[model samples]
Target: MSEVLVVRGEMQPWTDHTARQPVLAALLADVIPANRRTLILGPHSPLLIESVLAHSADVTILVRSVSDAEQLTETFGPCLHVVAGALDGLKRAAAVQPTLFEVATDGVQPFEVVVAADGLDRVLGYDSEHLSWTERLAAVRSLATPDAVVVLGLRNEFSMLNLLDRRPAHLRHGDDEWVPLHDDPTRPVSVDQFQAALPWPAQLYADFSAHTLVGVEAAATARPGHLPTRLAVAALESVDTPLLTSTTEPLESAARAGLLPAVPTSWLAVCNAPTPHTLYTHSGPTTLKATATETGWETTVGVVTPDLLGTVGYDSTVVPARVPGGESVETVLFRLAAAEDVPGFRKLAAALGEWAEDSRVLLRWDDVIVAGDTFAFGISGWVAPESVDKDDLLAAAWLRFHRRLVDGHRRHPWPPWMIGDELVSTWLSMSGVTLVDPTPATAPHVESAYAEQLAWGKQLAAALSVVLDSPEQTHPDLRTQLADADRARLELTELQGHVFGLERTLGFRNKAMKTRENRIRELRGQLQKATTANNKIHSSRCYALARRLAQFRNPRKVAAKARRILRQNLNKLRPAS
Candidate 1:
């Protein structure tokens, strides 16, 4: 059973809601003193507490929430002592009631190890007296023995993540931030300030996230494909927080200006510990810790299992911890491409081709580290399921690299129009692999690796299309211009379809008007012919006589004239008969 101490008059309505960070916990575990009395301040991940317990049997955890303290006691059992109280209340209780404070501390003695990795923000209770950043640090230090090991973490207000965050400060504020002291002037914002604030010498680490930590010197001197640069870039790229813009460009600019270490998301300071030169990161399920040595890099994996390879359909292979003595091929290739050195690229391709032909190992540009003329796999943990052809493997590797280049918006020396399989084929031909055509449809029959690579590329492309299409300005590379041209062409096609529909409608209307005009012309012609015939009939002599006889003044005169005409006609008819 664990010991639980609850301070009277402690804050009752406050609860800490901070999240657990595994990477930070791992780092803390590396520096925590072994077999010494340790005190953990504020809320922390259960993983960290477990690690601390493993190192030291006697551990004390102080939290403002009574519920949190009870939960810690339940989880840790007798190995942990939980104190539910604010800092001020603990201080007063120690002075007024020595027995109660002794129960919380296990004795009236100072701690040999003090860990405030969660920072000082969450230590104060709502009803307790407020303390500034420096005051909080002093309070934590006062509880530790004269030669105690102290591990501290501080959040940087001007970090790139905070600067790029789109949410307003008030909107991002949490319920526990009733008396937020993030803006305290005494708070350290840089490595120098943090070191200066501490009484003992401290080693600083630039904490990009829970999964990545780079030494201050390593980050300051990072370059294109150096391990530190790789880790930093990977960390920034994997961030899930919604930001006002992509951090890719900003990170590159920072690296170029040698300001990367100065603007990390957070800083970790370790006192009474050896200077740490190792870089630690968690890539997916694999935890990679690399340290630079005289010969080369000495890398170690925390967990070595088949699960590290994800879904590549390959058997488990244990990779060596030591890296080859050379620079990564990716770094050299990026340099060549950026300079637009076509001849140099071709020469390197030929050399890589020869190496691949000789050594039947799979070659990924980033995985292949080169020293002089020697090429070898750097840090990888998977093998092909079966024997794959050299041509297929080379083609797959180049095609994947091409996809990365396009996705990253990287520049190359190839023609602006040369893209997709065509450009890939060109590179392969230079590498002594002959492929007349390499389209997705024919990829399966020609090379199974090619088809598989294409499928993976399509899926990744869909996922990254949004980021690639962001409105941020980048180098106007061929891929970017091609994407823009494709959009323009699509718009043009729609406009042409709309114009064609309008033309068809106008043509139909013109045809209908022509038909109506022809009908009207024919009707007019018939009416003109009838009028001519009527005129001719009126001009005839018989018609004129009938008209004159009918116009007589009286009906009697008309009848007498009709009888005389009838008698004349009857006499003439009789003679004719």
Candidate 2:
């Protein structure tokens, strides 16, 4: 019994598809008044529409494609209304032209909650009159009741994704982008402008996909273990966009300067609703939900199924959640390091060392919350798989933090030249831990994870380390450097193989030379013995007369006479036979 109303002149052979943003849908669900009329403008994920239906049975979705409307109607039979029309034709007073049909909204009631999270880009049809961004906003506004809770999604043209995108303008869009109103003068480009455009007070959020939605203020002043900081890190680390360079350093700088909200991929404006500062991130297959509280963050898994930690190389026993009432140790340590407070940093390190000595699980600074002398774990469900030595655990934790610090371009008290194992050893010494080599054989999984993290960190660091003379110059330079390094490594490997072959050839040649030298020495010794024997025979008395006769001028004649005598002796012997 679902209603599918079609306004003639709707766009044909066109279906607008939007990405499914679960966290945004969850936020919208939280704000949508239960049992009230709701309006969803533009194409949204079916999952999101279902979430909307869960709160309110009376809902209407507007899309420009008749096929899309029919599909939605079939999917949600009797639960909601699907309207197929352009925004211009949705008004009750729309002109009924001969060429185009108008939608009749006479019986439709004003919506109590309005959601246009997909934004205003796809709300118009090809046959409809062109409308400016402001005009579209007005059209959407005209559908809602006064004081209605409205959630609007606005795309940031100056977002890091857009700025770093290397795609040509023509290639960046699809066929559906034929009538993009990017140059509309009335469009709100920033959070401030977006808020000003709304008639009601609105809370602005940086929507970084389904995993992260950070409040403007929270993002500006994010600290370690804070929901905004954690979620922002997770989102940045998980970016799949092919950008010319990493946005990690730029975003961190923006956050420090309180300009992070101005540069997100998109913004969400929620009016007349309470918004929780939260993070929805995944660890392996488990979804983690972290919400900010007055004391600290409370984190729990979103879906409670059978334990999957062991499959993901995590401890089977889930760590119990506790509301740790304190600032995170990471924040304090970072503050101390940035301020160059060596004594304070060392003292805290020593204290952390003392506490870690008896701890059963690995202690990451960000996971440890500190209130005066008391310390508690802030994150839950991250435990060591097996018992680990105190020193080894400390080394792993500090070394991982070291990589992050260097990779994130964070300032520290240590000298700039001190890096890698030297800095880690120095930090460990301050923590009263000896610098023993914790071989990978001792903890293979942890070591492998750390190695992977280190590699990623190094790559990120290299990508972000270019001089800021100009982005145009620096990005290519970094790429060139990476390519050159790879080429050099290949050349080195080839050279090593060549050198090995040459060494084998040289060894064979040396052996051959040694054998030839030994044969020459043996030949000389045999010739000298033969010469000594010939001299002894000549010195004999009976051979002296024969030697004198052989030395006569007729030596050839003597040889002929000897031959004749031998022939005669042979003839006499034959006759006797």
Task: State how far residue 138 of model 2 sits from its true place (Å).
Answer: 0.1
TM-score of each: 0.73, 0.68
The lowest-lDDT stretch of 10 consecutive residues in candidate 1 is 307-316
For residues 1-577, could you state the per-residue lDDT of candidate 1 as single tens digits? 7667876434565567766566766666678768988888888889888878889757888888888888888888877878888766666656655553353444345578888887777777767776888988887877876678888888888787777766788866577756667778898878888889997778888888665888887788765565666567667656666566656667767877888888778888888877544677764345666776766577776664543222233222445577754567877887799899989989998888887852223456766777677777765544443445667667757766786687676788888667776677678778877654444555444643234434533433333332222343433333346777897999899999999999999999999999999999999999999999989999999899889877887989779988999999989889553
User: Which candidate achieves the best lDDT against the true structure?
Assistant: 1
Best-fitting candidate, scored by TM-score: 1
Give stretches of model 2 more than 4 Å off: 1-3, 92-109, 176-178, 223-227, 276-303, 306-349, 357-362, 366-376, 384-396, 402-577
- Residue by residue across 82-145, what tens digits does model 2's lDDT show? 7788888776323533212223356343677889888888888888887888888887777776
Error of 1 at 307 (Å): 3.2
TM-score for candidate 2: 0.68
